[model samples]
Target: MASFEINGGKRLQGELVPQGAKNEALQVLCAVLMTPEKVTISNLPDIIDVNKLINLLQAMGVKIEKVERGTFIFQAKDIDLDYLQTEDFKNRASSLRGSIMIVGPLLARYGKGFMPKPGGDKIGRRRLDTHFEGFAKLGAKFNFDQQAYFYSVTAEKLKGTYIHLDEASVTGTANVLMAAVLAEGKTTIYNAACEPYLQQLCKMLNKMGAKISGISSNMLTIEGVSELGGCFHRVLPDMIEIGSFIGLAAMTQSEITIKDVSYENLGIIPQTFQRLGIDMELRGDDLFIPSQESYQVDTFIDGSILTIADAPWPGFTPDLLSIVLVTATQAMGSVLIHQKMFESRLFFVDKLIDMGAQIILCDPHRATVIGLDRKHSLKGIQMTSPDIRAGVSLLIAALSAEGKSVIHNIEQIDRGYQDIDLRLNNLGADIRRM
Candidate 1:
């Protein structure tokens, strides 16, 4: 269990390039299983989760060639189905929530898929019901082994049908979409998640000879094909990391330039940070955050308190709400952060409260933050990272605080961010891995 020893109250400056999207990487890596031809992927983030998925694919007999640092060519020519039932496979797959995605491509190509109960951040109850339900709607028989905590879906041949998802779950939509691409007929998915990552997946699938339409809408149409071929794909820059950098800049009063951010794809993220009074400008696909003496939060037009909440696509992302809450601690006004998707995400505010931020944890789903406005610098203390996003949030708070702070369980941070301590240290941050 490595920890971060941070010397707080240091201003940083430099150009930071965001890594490839982790969420999209997971989905695309699984998509490689649907084709036997060479599928080339670029801009893959070197993070724990993505690397784990790559290793899992390799274990399943996918031939992978590293063309460059963030580029790989994968050919799933000889996948070993029997490996899925092994204890080693179960132990590896059970540790990654992204492993659930493998079931879709496996079912599409092999007519059957099996997985141990997947694991991920302990943020909340992230159910796999949507994925299995969508599969069941598409003519797949689902079974669960309660004794082993395993799930399996099998089908002789999947026939596409209309599916109105109960929730616009991103991974669920991706899973079903992957399965539908190889089904026998047209599949229409209503209430689908239209995130950029999903759109990227659709585009890559289409390039691989799968027919898909409604690129950026709630409803998607997929025409089942005989088979899919390989295609080259590049993942978008991680918007969550971009949002984290924005918050870090505001919290530390630093001028930082984030390079090649795929500015257009970052829906409402920049504006949301601006709503928190964090000034940022677009400089030809890059985001420039100037050092701020202080920022002010905005209120509703009718003079009500400002509220930021997460919803399906086009709404603020729930992943960044933790960063927003931590960033708002130094703003000039107050804002309510409602984490509608997950209940326990707001529980991290207690650590911030200990760091001298004025936050009211109204409930498991909401928090109200009254900005200290830099009148008093936060005093760092020992803390443990709860999850990936919250870990980065606490790191941001510690960077802007006074005195020394020790952050334990930094493995959580490493799961998402790539070499976070080394990257931040390059930007003049005092983060030492101990």
Candidate 2:
């Protein structure tokens, strides 16, 4: 029931150190269950989803110790497999999408695994059929009950095989990678998700003795190994937060510098934003966003209207489309945004329309945004965060609007960004967490 009260129309100017990648942190935490030795992860973000995942791991008897402020030492040497069947475990397991990944490691190490339906953004129907399908292909049998989804594999030894995933689902790819690492033969996953988060998972697995090739491509080759050892790995910076900061600076007419961003890993993000006429400078590893009065949407070379769409990794991320849509509302021109990954993601544009934004909801999957160009200021109003990315988008809108705005259901925002209100406050934004 917490909310954010934001007084809008302030120019933010300061330097911000981005936190560790939330997506990678979740996967790395679950990977600890695959080994009995100690695993140390550095640059961990202090966020709610991570804390919840850590609590779930601790409940299952994983020993976690804080080595430093943003570092942790975790050892799953004495994991109690029985905890995975309890009611408390089911409730906690169903609280986040990252919890689904535990099934692979558990089933690979232990013969069986059980978890309830996972929870995440309600943007659309996120199916676990892909995960189960990939697991079943890897010799795991799946069963469902009224209370939870149960998975058990009867094969005495798992034998790897080729898997062509139905879609390049991020978590699905992670599950398959985790399961394939301990199987018997060579496993080739075609049409995989090669995002930076997945790449980090691959690197960490290699550190733990998993033979994985094709680090940043769709075709992943994994040679199953008998045992995995412990190793220390550092998680990457949060690119989604970096994208959010880019959107915030453009929307509020602010000059801000984001520090420690992995410039090379930002494959298409920088160029994607440039499509909207938001130019950014990379000073070594940092990103600098200069203050701008208005951004213009670029047109096609042939003089047709520009269209920006989301695709799999190496393409634009579906998660950042919300931020782009919201930021485009305050830009100088018009563009079409197509969010192909989720059906319900574009439904939040109605909230922006209520705030006097010029948006045309073409359908559930696409919208055309006409920028207001600093000529019109969005009026303050009460709004609810429908999902994680949309929550951050609404916060940006609230911050760019004229009076006071209240954003309810901030727990969704807490799932991804770390201390968002406080960080924005440090950048001279008038945001208070209430």
Candidate 3:
């Protein structure tokens, strides 16, 4: 297990260019399997999860060539379908949560797909029902192996139909959309996840000859094409990372400029932080967060306590809630962070509380953080990272805390953020990776 040794209580100053979207990269990389032609994708993040998915594709016989850093050309001309039955394939597929997405393209082009129970962050119960259920709606026969925890979908031909999702799941919507693009006739998906990354997928697919309408809306209509062709696509900057950098700047009292953020796509993220009383200046495409001694949480118009909750698109993202909770530690007022999607996401408050933040773990879904308002500084302590978001949140806390802090299991952090320590160190943060 890798660990990060951080020396805290120093203000940082520099610019950070956010990496390409991790969530978007996962979806589009899997989409390469739907076509035999070459697809050139740029701005790919060099993170563990993204790299894992890329490697998984390569193992399945997709010819991949590196054009340069953050760019690749993929051709699925000769995919070895027999490899799907191997134990090596099962083990590799089961380890990555994103691997479940490959089933969509495989089932679309090859008439069958199989995946073991996919693995990812243990934030809560991330069910695969949405994916398989959507597949079943598209005329695919679905089966599950109880003993092996395996899932399989097969069909001679898929016929698209109307699908109203149980939940607006991003991955679920992506999986179903990929399958429906090659199905016979039209597919209308209501209540689809309209996240920017999902929209990026739709745009990419449209460019590749898939007739997809409603690019930025929940109701997506896809007119199935006989086959999809190759198209060049570039991923947007990761909004979650941009949000993290904003919080980090405020918490550590750093003047950091996040460049080429694709500001318009970051729905509600900037305003959500501003509601926390963090001052930011939007200079063209860059977000400049100046150093602050103390920031304040805003109250409702009726003077009630501010509640920051996560919802579907156009609402604040749940991924950055952990960052928000940690940033509020030194703010001027209290804010309630309601993590609606995942139950265990708020469980990381114990680590922050140990670091001297006044946080109340109301339950599994919510946390009330009472800002110290800079009257007190968090004292450093050794801790372990539970998940990706929590790990980065803890790292941010450590950077703003007093003395030294040791964080174990930094692989969780590496899975999402690319070269986090080195990037922050360039901006004057004292973090040693071991």
TM-scores, all candidates, are: 0.99, 0.98, 0.99
Residue-wise lDDT of candidate 1 within 1-434, one digit each (tens)? 99999999999999999999999999999999999999999999999999999999999999999999889999999999999999999999999999999999999999999999998898888999999999999999999999999999999999999999999999999999999999999999999999999999999999999999998999999999999999999999999999999999999999999999999899999999999999999999999999999999999999899999999998888999999999999999999999999988888888999999999999999999999999999998999999999999999999999999999999999999998899999999999999
- The candidate with the higher lDDT, 1 or 2, is 1
lDDT of 2 at 434: 90
Q: Give the distance in Å from residue 39's predicted Cα in candidate 3 to where it truly belongs.
A: 0.5
In the range 118-145, model 2's lDDT, one tens digit per residue, is 8888888898888888888988777877
Query: Which pairs in model 3 have colliding backbones?
Result: none
Error of 2 at 297 (Å): 0.6
At residue 402, give the lDDT of candidate 1.
100
Q: What value of lDDT does candidate 1 attain over all alpha carbons?
A: 0.96
Decoy 3 TM-score against native: 0.99
Candidate 3 differs from the real structure by a C-alpha RMSD in angstroms, to one decimal, of: 0.6
